[model samples]
Target: MAGALRAMAGPSAQPPSAIRHPPSAIYNSSRPMQLGTYRLIDRLGTGGMGEVWRAEDTKLLRQCAIKILPANLAADPEWKERFLREARSIASVTHPNIATIYNIEQDGDTLFMAMELVEGEPLTKLIERGPMIPLDAVRVATHVADGLAEAHRKGIAHRDIKPDNIIVSTRYVKVLDFGIAKQIGGTTDANLTQGNMVIGTPHYMSPEQAMGRSVDSRTDMFSLGVVLYEMLSGRKPFTGNAVTETLLNIVMHEPVDIAKAAAGITPALADVVRRCMKKQPDQRYADCDELRTALVKSLKEDPKLARQSRIPTIAVREARRLEPEPPPRSAVSSHPAPQPTPAPAPPARGTRAHRALVADDDPATRYILGSILQRYHIEYDEADNGADAVKLLKNREYSLIFVDLLMPRVDGWGVIDYVRGHRGNVAPRVFVVTGVQNQKLSAADQDVVTALLYKPLDIAKVEQLVQKSA
Candidate 1:
């Protein structure tokens, strides 16, 4: 499995420099540039065919996401027309999960589309954090399916549905980059001529798409299935170092069983994923809605099946929904003037320090948590068992506590119950830190815990949690 991942990692891991262009060169050129009265602030991101910008709509007084085709691409009348057609098709489908397009405009050499600016990180960033828990994965997939169902209802198909294009925010999921998406039965002669150019990320491409066959809504389902698989398993189902080999696998090979790859994953969940990933579009779920129904069923059965699955020592991380922070105040302006601002007072000495109590029978887990807390400048107390943790809690008031589920003497759940029952009014927020990935917790008990941080903790994520609690 390691060798397979290593082989498939190369092509997908494009160098940052290769994918991004210098922002100034694209927007600051001597060309008559105005995208429907919106002045470009700066380039936000770029891709192979176009550039996305952070722009201010002077007419509307709002910030919007602006995608622009470069002069060279826009000059090609054939590609230019197809691009406009794609924008129109995407604009026609309206859903909460899909980003809304405000307008399409042309100003001399520049052609661009203005849309909503979603404040969130892409799924790619979330995946980089760690593997997501099954429930969270199901939630995200369901939302995406809702959006796709809307599109399919309108006979529109999103040809590309990969991690890089799906945004995860505190309150919503926004699907972005509908560059290659098309409306079924609405293609022009120009589109038909531009043949054989593949679209979509290689690893997530559906078999029909990879084989250059005609596609439908099922194609999107297959790609999303791959995304869900990666979300839960922390790896793509089919992969290879060479593009041809990867494409070949998607066209002819079957993916490894997800349950086998990730222990503790329910068989029902794995089967649902496999069905959606079937090589033949007809063999897969009829549409996004059907696939979503299967996912919902799988989630409902997960709790029962979880008890039977062998628990793994390694922990699965929940994908964080990043919240946007207020922009920092600027000290200087581009107008060559400096603004004077009062310096903030320093924090009170004792008030700034926070203590966290960590309880775990595993010496390694305790050591890891201690090291992470230290790196974040958090004071911590450790106990080997739940009883020891409760004892320590009685004497010292901790801001946060991390408890392991299975330990000598009193277990983690026992400690939680004791604290909740006896110290109801004053108990500190407890974070149930455990390695048992599939353990079922009663909904009532789950509410008392501030949050659950799985084992194999990423120090950065641990610090983030601690900082948030502080």
Candidate 2:
């Protein structure tokens, strides 16, 4: 997982290393060495909005981290408000896991913030090296969630909670950069966003965030789920070739299961990950507190779970590719398998010799899928239940499989478990397309399923996704 994900670049899109400030002499000649009562010692890091520096609070004779808002940005009244809002958001949350904000400074057009100087490394850097020690992974997530729980209780939501924004010091896990935090229940008009635009990093965003919906405390839980998965699996939960595609993936796809990605991930721990990442906000943990309690229980039940760290000591396992098999005739036909008025020739398979399969008990749904596949010129097979799907899967390697959660015989989740655990099984991208009310996947299924969509299936999205693979 780590080997495959080194290419991800995490949520910040920054390299998995902390910014190393150059000599103070570099900034001394041009940028002001002093601002108000603090003297800039050196830069800590920089973002689109501004740079942070290791500064000395000459008035108090103490060291602090200072964030400076860019002059260009300060020129914009809206940005100025957001800058001040950022300060208030951080100041509102007082927790061991959250960095403290001391004061906001306005030196003429230059605006800056005095904050705690954390001597630590970015969690992204640790992730790049591979997964963490299991116990450490749980502790890091629990501590952060606990902190966010308090902030949420205070009606604040940290919209951006990703690896780069997290720092792991020798003794503490500190969440940094609340610059995107929003007051819970704040109007859409109150959002720092320009217009109705959504603001967040695509990779870790919740489906609601991805769709630009009204977000709440659960939004941070979704992002935390992404962080936890990456910490335990050594890979981001959702990823893509482009930003829009990644956002679409978050809203439209299910990530590979963590237990599969890393050997021996416990059911309890996996459940925590699953609930935290539910696409619908209502499907996730009620709040960060609930999430924290679950994390705590998981640790209490199996202290040895920590001993089975997915952190690879030898070589990082590059995720295996899915196998492509010949098409098979589906058993237990539902709705008499849709037959085109005029029998059409089998759709031409792509350069990749792969058979796509659709397994669902619903005759109408199967009919729809069959028709769409025919129009897209993609050859496919169908299964009416989990048992038949497994039988077909065994006979032929599939390139893609769309499964229904509540079919007779074996369930969708059972099929996934079987396929994933099968020896030398080809890794076909599996999607769950169902009308099951509030369908919830087992922790293991979360890692096995590729994408999920609620019925009535969006034929257009199905066409687009299938065509790309084709």
Candidate 3:
């Protein structure tokens, strides 16, 4: 029974010596190929599992990025199957924003995948250079979302979405590395050990993924949320001293307030991230389409806020977070830039404690926002919709107000317009947070809103905005 299971689960056998390795440990070295129909021109890089080489396909006479499994691992039946599965799944996805898989072949014992050679820097490199401009982040994230949407449509979950998996070329953003992806209907019980092995890079795994739960397309959305958060703020939403601790936090802890993580980042951008990081899969945006819609709306409502809100410290920290930490035995030394920690502020006074009113039709969004406010010990009130929100504003005063753009009976924009038209002088620091797409606030509406916080609000960012206004 065990042998039958093994055979059924394992990929077709190939010769072990066929697995290819770079000539030297150093990356980007030029070498000639010893096997296959391709000639290796230069080494691209190596990862934990394999080496990627820039090679010429002699038959096709075209350049390709050939990813090869290490020789030792190639003999392992299960690993080979998993690798082939990943390559085939990635090849099935066809999107402009996703890296294309050209072919998959097993030469002897070595499994190789030839994919579109993207001439560009990884998102990690860009983050290392500095915080991405908000507009640039939005643009890149939109493209990523588009790619994810396509993948999700095909019932494939990326499983690993991190800065390292994203490539930014001059004209396009490509999402790569689908080595851990699984089809929706694939057996969850297949290779239980490998499935539970925590197959993703730390710092970017969603709570569900970290906890070893069966993942769906929503998992990719959460990963994208982390990526988007890092792109805009320049730091990951969660961090810790060790991999286990980091994964534990992802599964259990709420992320640091975005505003606290990076001061001056727009609340709207923070909200988008918060929604993406929703712990429960159902709580996140239904898919990448929803996320893309929210990002596009943010770009339209406050292009400047999106453009100028990038915090450099966040990016530097992200670069440090994504790169593999040096082994203790390594002779070389590299020092990451110092990260500035946000000082804890004194508690707010009774009755006057930085007050906020959250208006949203979605119970989950409101609940999450309320939780964030509670964590910061801020006094806040909730309104089910725009009408209640407007009524609450008239009856009492708040230091800040978070208005959801899409709500029944007078939406966020309507409430803002009403408040400005009638109680212009009494308007508090109004922030419109919404998931609505292609929303453009009129000049009059803009005058009344101090800021626009996008939906799926990041709690840390909300706290920062409240403190800034306070």
Task: Tell me the deviation in Å of residue 4 in model 3.
Answer: 31
- How many residue pairs clash in model 2? 7
> What TM-score, over all chains together, does every model reach?
0.61, 0.60, 0.59
Q: Which runs of model 3 end up more than 4 angstroms from their true locations?
A: 1-34, 188-196, 306-470
Name the better of 1 and 2 by TM-score: 1
For model 3 the local lDDT of residue 93 reads 88
What TM-score number comes out for model 3? 0.59
Question: Model 2: C-alpha RMSD to truth?
Answer: 21.2
How would you encode candidate 1's per-residue C-alpha lDDT over 299-322 as one tens digit per residue? 544331222223322232221223
Residue 345, candidate 1: Cα error in Å is 49
Best by lDDT: 2
> If the candidates were sorted by their TM-score against the true structure, best first, what order would they fall in?
1, 2, 3
What is the alpha-carbon lDDT for the whole of candidate 3? 0.68
* lDDT (Cα, tens digit) per residue for candidate 2, span 1-470: 22222233233333212212233412334678899999999887676347789999999999999988767667778666767888999898899789999999899778889999988889999889887645557878987997899899999998888998899854467998877788998763433454233455768888876666678989999999999999988898898886666777787779998777656666888889988999888999988888988887775444334234435522112111121232343575332222222234332343324667899875545755666566545678999999999998888777778888788889887888877887243467778887654778777787778778765455446655665655
- Residue 370, candidate 2: alpha-carbon lDDT: 69
Worst ten in a row by lDDT for model 3: 9-18
